[model samples]
Target: MGSLMHLIPVTDPADPRLAAYTSIREKDLTSGHGGRFIVEGKVTLETLLTRSRFAVESLFLAESRLAPLADLLAKVPADVPVYTAPQDIMDQVAGFPMHRGVLACGLKGDIPLPGEFISEDKPRSGPLLLLSDISNHDNTGACFRNAAAFGAGGLLLDERCCDPLYRKAIRVSSGASLFLPYAHGGTGLDMVNAVLNAGYTVWAMTPRAEAQPMQSLPVPDKLAILLGAEGPGLPDALIAAAEPVRIPMSAGFDSINVATAGAIALAHVFGEKQG
Candidate 1:
């Protein structure tokens, strides 16, 4: 059980509880833990707490790092433990500068399958973003933030994409990933098949000349923006299978960031903003 008073004080860096916390900048590139993701700082943690999908087991906060939050510590479930450490150790554990002064460890919960998220009644005709294989956390997170801000319905991620619940993605998402309805860790091919089968146009957002531009694209009433990675873009196999579509842009500029493209697409698709 967690107690603000009993918060275990760790003076040594060898503590096992702190091992999961990694630097935000380098973790996605080199963290050895397989199939594991991290969520750093306070806002991201708070967002995760609100969403019921993931189970947050513990939190590690630097005693000196008191600048990160409000007085909501007491509001967490009494059973969830909160640990405190020195600023230096917290910095080391985070693997980056610890401006926010708090870190948390959580297990990823089961997410909806591709088909389920598309028809997900939670958003009710909301714009959806489908990711092909965007490995970068920044893009994934940014895409989520835009989806939430613009009232997009939900988010769909294929197997190749980075975990949205991961610390880096969560932080970049400003915790929007949690607020947004997303079904993670599905296969691109399966997601494409399901979206197509469900009467969605599966507008593949790319710059291929033959692809229909966003201006002319028939983004359905219930839409899913098929986005790819930063440089690699969508795999040819996936694009070939999906309904070819693109977002219109200046001739020289091939595209915008996946997240930006998503926001633009959402505005166009849900232009009327019904209820």
Candidate 2:
């Protein structure tokens, strides 16, 4: 927990102490200092501060919103400086309206590689969501939310997937992105092979007619549900390497959003297990 003494008030948007909060959009695209990422909204800030793996560098909050977070702030480490500014100053610093007025910057923990994440000793008895080329932040976050909701063991993301810690992603996920364990590494094919070697049945999600219906598919003791990018779906070669499955839809519709598909698949997989 943090004390009120840790709080520092800043009226100047350009103050060096507040640099971490400056031009957030541009910084998000270009900054790479110490694996740092932004946590937005009160829910996400709470989630960020609670996790041991993540270390807070600084917290920049709108002055008006500061008192509401006293309990949450008490949990923050004393060494982490907390900065408060008026709404106009925060808006000036972030170059945005700063509606939620809750922002914090923190460093990412040492993330495990895909192989390390799915070790040989760990038996896979539950479902894992495997993502490939899922570039959209919202979809990635939504998938994380769905995975957590359905009691997935973890997530395996291919190299092409966007960082789940992105501000929009975190906001969309409602902070589930921080709670779920995930590994990002290798090509989509590499992930498929690694999970297969780890005793997981990799089920590739596609909208093809030949694919097995998700509801009827047998639930393996260990399963990995593979989702592709937004429009193109999974690569054909990758799909060929695994058991292809699909969510049945109406006659004209070809498919649904990847995140929606993930939710449906996760529900079916977890539901069958509980049944």
RMSD of 2: 1.8
lDDT of each: 0.73, 0.86
> Which stretches of candidate 2 lie above 4 Å from their native place?
29-31, 120-125
Q: How close is candidate 2 to the true structure, as a TM-score?
A: 0.94
Best by TM-score: 2
Error of 1 at 29 (Å): 12
lDDT of 2 by residue, 152-200 (tens): 9889998899888777888798888787888887899988998899778
Highest lDDT, which number? 2
Which 10 residues in a row give candidate 2 its minimum summed lDDT? Answer: 26-35
For candidate 1, give the lDDT of residue 185.
58
Model 1 CA deviation exceeding 4 Å by range: 1-3, 22-36, 66-70, 115-123, 217-219
Against the true structure, what is each candidate's TM-score? 0.84, 0.94
